[model samples]
Target: MTMDKQFHEILSDTRQDFSGWDFSYITRTGRMGSQLLSWSYGSMAIPLIRKAKSMLDMGTGGGEFLSLLSPFPKEAFATEGYLPNVPIARKRLEPLGVKVVQIEDDFNLPFQNRQFDLILNQHESYSPEEVRRIIADDGIFLTQQAGGLDCREINEMMGVPLNEEFAHWNLETAVMELEANGFEISTRKEEFPIQRFYDTASLIYYLQAIPWQIPDFDPEKYADPLYEIHQIIRENGYFDVSQHRFIIQSRPK
Candidate 1:
């Protein structure tokens, strides 16, 4: 650990008990914020859920987003791959008559063919072919994805390489994959919006929570950049990064 007391204190902060993909601790406190997109995934999904008779919510982290979609269909199911979140999702969604299933592989979902009339995903990886297999011919699949360049500046500033695995993940490639896998794209939109961190601690908390943001993020290894960012935040009142986001609504052809 670095010997700098203040930086060390920030590193040792225990406030970031991240769970269920919730960022409320920072967001609710106005410590972190991002510019709003033109379309709201929740707004778009609500209407689809209302019209569907059976629905599936993939990667329902802690059931946070799915729980908000009230009046769930009679045959509703949510799948979560993160182990710690499975029980949490079940506890939150089961009472709403949603079956929460723990899953391992995105390519191998545990569901029957043509099982869902609506499928919703937010920031979750999915196999386009598998999605096509499980969804009804008329079923709509809605997703809001974080593109490959999301917050790339942060990694640049930290002197780290971007995660190569998702380097080519963007709206164009995603649409191409889905179209080839039998989905007819109905609506697609991509946006790059400003994301601001009011404090250096919040930025650290965020990177720590979302490990994929900087796969090799280590306070000890990146202490110099950490101090530099902290100084910038102190002088400028905030740090800024761009958010890469896209939304797609599609159905099997």
Candidate 2:
């Protein structure tokens, strides 16, 4: 098939409904892969989850990750800010006695003060004061965050403008924010891992799903750059990009 034909076909196939926070298609196609982390976030969270009587999972996208750590606390609750993911999360987690809440904003948590003994957050924006308000005096907060510079290489490859929102959001900034909000930081780690995309299709699909990476991204609008990237991928085996991530564990001061 011609390169143009192949590009169009890949674009068409990738433009599907990306619901439920699942990336099975990206993985199944064997087009995208990432380096493994040195430490397991799930393993670190399991013991903490088992010990807490009340737990809250922030931005529990489709509750997929939270569901795996099941046999939850007696008061298990999950909050999803994305409208599409809220219903999906409810469908998956409600059956497990997990109350899936739809939160309109991350700044304000819709719960009573000191409502939870443990809060788990993954790739979610949060208000530190709000977290401090809702968490028990001795509660724990564990979060795995996507650092601001995550996937910057992709932006450079496509000539897209870099997002400055997370430019200063690193381990130091996170620790300062948490401590400033009355939390004592116990564990902190950050990593910049390599993410490899073997095909242009995976890259397009990822950009489509994550609009924040390229705020004005549209396959049609970015056809030129996308084509250029596809040509580079055709010449090379894969495209490489850096992915920034950080994990922090803290308790009320």
Candidate 3:
């Protein structure tokens, strides 16, 4: 598929209906997803990150990476697509002297060419155009994404089988997209057997609201009972799930 078409599909898949969802419940007891993201980036990009003056952390959720990156960077700015996350991120990062910007209205970054030495995306939604257009010639782009096989079990639980074509998420595809955008591959790191515990109901609650899967699914037909089953898993001492994370580091060609 063309990059534009692929990007459209990605955007569609990640749209979540938060009309009645409870945010406080998740944040209070939710699993810290950043632990996985941090582990992936530390393993993939930290060693290659040399001295840099300015850096951008795309989709800097919770600003954990930005906080960690502050010591090594002279100036660090973060962009987040979701506005609800902005306040918390600002609160968490601003105290640490990091600048957090909201990108909800604009996906095309407002920076000039070669303005930054490093750009990082830890599980951010990125298209080839955004990557190609925004990255500075000498800047580095490091991305860590949830692997293709990661969402299968959850999808099965939801009973809405994700279309295979729409589910084409893997290391080879990620490498190809980066290379196609003129990024020379520097490192590809894979994490196998990533295990996490989730109360089945909580998992479904997130699965329903989060965009890890596709969009426009039938929730009433599937979401409720799935949560009930999740309760079973929770009572059984949580469900042990495995996922793979692919971290690719690329530099401008």
Runs with alpha carbons beyond 4 Å of true place in candidate 1: 1-5
Maximum-lDDT candidate? 1
lDDT of 2: 0.89
| Residues 75-134 of candidate 1: C-alpha lDDT, one tens digit per residue | 999999989999999899999999999999999998999999999999999999999999
C-alpha lDDT values of all predictions: 0.91, 0.89, 0.64
Worst 10 residues of 2 by lDDT: 1-10
Q: Which residue pairs show backbone clashes in model 1?
A: none
Candidate 2 lDDT by residue in tens digits, 50-154: 999999999999988899998898899999988999899999999998999999877787899999999999999999999999999999999999898999988
**Which candidate model has the greater lDDT, 1 or 2?**
1
RMSD of each: 1.7, 1.8, 9.6
Higher-scoring candidate on lDDT, 2 or 3:
2
Better candidate by TM-score, 2 or 3: 2
Q: Estimate each model's TM-score.
A: 0.96, 0.95, 0.71
Looking at model 2, the pairs that clash are: none
Best to worst by lDDT, what's the order? 1, 2, 3
Q: In candidate 3, which residue pairs get closer than 3 Å at backbone N, Cα or C atoms, i.e. clash?
A: 200-230, 201-230
